[model samples]
Target: MVVLNWNGADDTIRCLHSLDAAALETPFRVLVVDNGSSDGSVGRIRREHPDAEILELPSNLGYGGGNNAGFRRAEEMGADEVLFLNNDTVVDSGFALPLLTVLRGEGGAGAVVPKIFYMANPSLIWYAGGEVSLRSGLVRHVGLRRHDGPRFSRPGTTGYATGCCVGLRVGVVRALGGFDEAFGMYAEDVDLSLRLRAMGLRIVFVPSSMVWHRVSGAFEGRLLRKLWLRTASTVRLLQKHGTPFSVPLFLLLLPLRLVPAAAGMFFSRLRREESV
Candidate 1:
């Protein structure tokens, strides 16, 4: 398990405690990447789980940066695979083994993500990998809210998976160089997914592997903040893939992007029974 930590001392402690109890079929090491946290988290973990490995950075490298550091350590350890779990997550006891089982057989499956449930609301599905419609330029969940029936219960390839709790092959990640640090935070996963797809690799959703995540805890619950980062990252991603004519293409698509967000706001207010 590779976790990135800031000042989340309490959550970090809890995550580690859960990992200690999660019985695995194979031996797996836990590496905590401390992104220059001043909460004395390193000291706390050392005092608590002395056997666990810890990597400390000089400053906060954001999510992509922190995870990249952990990925490097995992690579150096010669690990066959690396699983990235959020500091605010509790991995299910059967998580790692099931993922490993699927990974060993699935060709083109460079990365695999488990079914994530809201730590606060375990019944709700946080994400189910879906199709990215190029025509609409929107991403949708294949089995978001419907249920965990035959549709969602099966493991298959997806356009992308949440970075919250993903298991990746070490070689694939090393070749790709972990998450794109240029993204800093938001949409780094999206950028990573696109790159993997470009390489003819697949990102899969494995339902048997599960984890409970505290949604948006690291970024806090700031809509504007999420929007700003997401929009900016999307722009950067498009820009990189977009050629010199990218400007004209973005111009053509800018309205398409705004319309949905605007409509979403209107419906959100309507659902709350607030006057527009």
Candidate 2:
């Protein structure tokens, strides 16, 4: 398992503790890649989880670079597969085995993703699966903010696998050159999934495996920055993988989406300030 840490020692440590307590038949090692955190994250994680291997980078390399570093290390360590998990998630005790079962089973599967729910409200889904529309340049979660039901219980292939808690076949990912680092943070998973699909491999979703994510934990107080990164990454994604109409459609719809969202945020902030 690889967990990327960037000044989030508390969340990272909690995730590590959950992994430690998980019941899995397969032996796995935790590799915490510290993305040049200056918050003493390295020392704290090292002290708390002495057994986990720590890979310290020189600076913040964003999500792709950091996880790519972890992938390389896992390859060197002779790992056949790797689980790229967010530092702000808590896994179910039986999560790993289900994903592994799917990944190691028959057919050509590049990756397997676990069912993800909101940490604040465990019954609400964050990402049951994923969908990508190249024509519209829209990538969305299958069951965003919805209650988990029989609809999400079936195991099958999906358009994409989220990086939040996806288990990948290391050899195949290495062959595809890992994630496109061009995506600093957002949409890299979508890019990777498209690549996998192009290679005739399936991105499987295993509902039995589950985890809870503290959604947007890393961008809690940075709404504008998050929006900017997401928007820029979306543009890049469309440029790289979209159909002819994708970019134009995205551009046409961009202002329509952003204007209302930005207005709501501004008004919400003004209201908070006035209340204060």
Please, what is the TM-score per model?
0.84, 0.92
**Which of the numbered candidates is closest to the native, going by highest TM-score?**
2
Candidate 1, clashing residue pairs? Answer: none
Model 1 Cα lDDT, one tens digit per residue, 1-276: 798899987788888887887745556789999999988989998898898899999999999999999998888888888888889888787778877776677588888889876565566666767565333345555654333566667778888867788888888888887899998777677777778888898888888887876656665435566667766776676666545665456557767777765554344334333321
Tens digit of lDDT per residue, candidate 2, span 150-262?
99989999999898988988888888899899889899999998998999999999999999987777875677987798888988999998878899998788877887656
User: What's the lDDT for residue 190 in model 2?
Assistant: 92
TM-score of 1: 0.84
The C-alpha lDDT values of all candidates are 0.76, 0.88
Candidate 2 residue pairs in backbone clash: none
User: What does the lDDT come to for candidate 2?
Assistant: 0.88
What's the true lDDT of residue 63 in model 1?
A: 92
